[model samples]
Target: DQQVKQNSPSLSVQEGRISILNCDYTNSMFDYFLWYKKYPAEGPTFLISISSIKDKNEDGRFTVFLNKSAKHLSLHIVPSQPGDSAVYFCAARTFSGGGADGLTFGKGTHLIIQP
Candidate 1:
């Protein structure tokens, strides 16, 4: 069974607007989560992240929020720009090992920013 899921296959937002992406996980073992943004023919790059202990984390225009009790997390981008149009993947992992083997990623959600 897929432990992490992004229910929405795609999301469209107007430029200069706010974009919100949602993710859900069923595994309680997951203690840390990350959001990765990927462009066409390019590898995913780390965008924002939030730990289970914190409810929110922000980095400039990108912000991530976690609700441990609900096993849910969201990424918000304010003033969405044309360059922000890409596929966003939600990944989760336990704080066990330092390797990437423990990471679980959701089927990315494509965000389309229209100008």
Candidate 2:
């Protein structure tokens, strides 16, 4: 089974603090990992990603780390802001799958940036 799991359903943090979200996977074939941020009534926007070959990646205030040996990954948001208060979804995918390949998303973690 190709299952991506986000253990925490939500996380709360003070503004300007670091917010860390964790995710795990059961399938080793997943090559592409992505994180999406969503606001109310709007579609999720791609925040960052890392290929399976890489161990760590970062973008400005966002960072993603992948550990293939453990089948675990995490997203870190530094100096969390009020605008960053939204749901975050972690996803993984592969192109070589038998069917039309697409993203597999976790339920999402509701990040609360306390202002």
Best by TM-score: 1
**Where's the lowest-lDDT run of ten residues in candidate 2?**
93-102
Instruction: After the best TM-score superposition of candidate 2, give how far the Cα of residue 68 lies from its true spot, in angstroms.
Output: 0.7
Q: Where is model 1 more than 4 Å wrong at Cα?
A: 97-101
Worst-scoring 10-residue span by lDDT in model 1: 94-103
lDDT of each: 0.94, 0.94
What is candidate 1's local distance difference test score? 0.94
Candidate 2's residue-wise lDDT over 37-114, tens digit each?
999999999999999999999999999999999999999999899999999999999878477379999989999999
The candidate that wins on lDDT is 1
